[model samples]
Target: MPVFSCADAIGGGTEPNGSEVVAVRVGQHDGYDRLVIEFNGPIPAYSVTGRSGTSFTTSPKGQTVTLGGTNGVLIVMHSIVNWTSYLGPYAFEPNFPVLREARQIENFEGYQQWALGIQGSPCLRVTTLTSPSRLVVDMAATR
Candidate 1:
């Protein structure tokens, strides 16, 4: 198993060109609230950083995005292709114990951006899985 931390997690697959994001899902686990980003191809280069503000603005457009909780985390991925293939909602409010909401704020050019609203400060464990080719972000649930 990979280690978890409150610091930023950076790194992803070696898909030289680009990949399509097929699905995004959220679930509650025993010790963490999980957010899964499923891709049609290899996972793209990405970085997960905890944002300082609760409110965030969209890229390029500069429009404000509203999230449900007090803290936020920004996920930026490179070499993301075919945004039209992602049929899931661009925004959702799951309201889990730690992860409160999420929104795909940007999908322009070859870049994709997502914002997550969370409660408290949870440690993050980012893992890349095969067979399905997805990125799993696990936020530790507070007691």
Candidate 2:
């Protein structure tokens, strides 16, 4: 079993083609830490991959994202541009054993980017749901 919540979001989101990155949420479950991103409509293709370095830099733009953690999970949403700002007073990071940092990196050309600085890179799993479209991420709290 698991739980879900939309606890943090800053600067709101941008409207590109009438679509926006509606929310980024986090919650503590009995066995894992859960994260969810919501869209105003159906979700598009996305990827969640573990990073090998402490920071990630976007292509062509060279914006380096520094997230201090032993592990990193890069999240990219294809089909929507950022349409929002997520930095300074708007940054969202749980700073927990499972998730250390979360940010809205880029939202340009119909693509959105986010990252999760994680502790120890625990097992990561992903799922998608409709009815106000969401991408759910579950990271194991225990090895």
Candidate 3:
């Protein structure tokens, strides 16, 4: 229910360089939480590694969900060039049950900000010029 949009930031054309926005959604499924990521544009070849280091390859564009630990989720967008470089590595920790409550806060305002780091080549920025993309993280309430 809670929707976080990164388009407002990059869509405004503030960053002349290419930019890629990842929108994340979190929800509860059975006993574990599920994360649904929607890629707005072309994404480079990458994988989602669990906190334990288990990695899974992802397609260039589409949506996918995986179940695992509650250490939160990390989205690593690599091989990014131009404007897309602005979108560095981003992570999210979504609250269960209240998931719908968070989506109400669009424009990424009032939401907890996660730390993002560049994987390699600090000088080289991940850049992209196209529609806004997204990465959603849904947290399940602990019973």
Among these predicted structures, which one has the highest lDDT? 1
Candidate 1 lDDT, 1-143, residue by residue in tens: 88778899889865645679888988999988988998878889999998665688898799997788878888889888776667767887899988999999888877888899998785789999987899899888863
| TM-score of each model, paired residue for residue | 0.92, 0.75, 0.32
User: Which of the two, 1 or 3, has more lDDT?
Assistant: 1
Rank ordering of all candidates by lDDT, starting from the highest: 1, 2, 3
lDDT of 3: 0.32
lDDT of all predictions, in order shown? 0.84, 0.66, 0.32
* Superposed Cα deviation of residue 109, candidate 2 (Å): 1.3
True-structure Cα RMSD, model 1 = 1.6
What's the distance in Å from true for residue 37, model 3? Answer: 2.7
The model with the greater lDDT, 2 or 3, is: 2
Using lDDT as the measure, name the better of candidate 1 and candidate 2: 1
Q: What's every prediction's RMSD, in angstroms?
A: 1.6, 6.9, 14.6
* Candidate 2 lDDT for residue 13: 29
Across 1-143, the per-residue lDDT of candidate 2 in tens digits comes to 33322222222223334446677788777767778887776566666776666588864487887886777777776656455532232256777667777776666677777777777753676777778777888877766
Model 3, span 12-62: residue lDDT tens: 222222324455454567533444544545544333322322122233322
Error of 1 at 142 (Å): 2.5
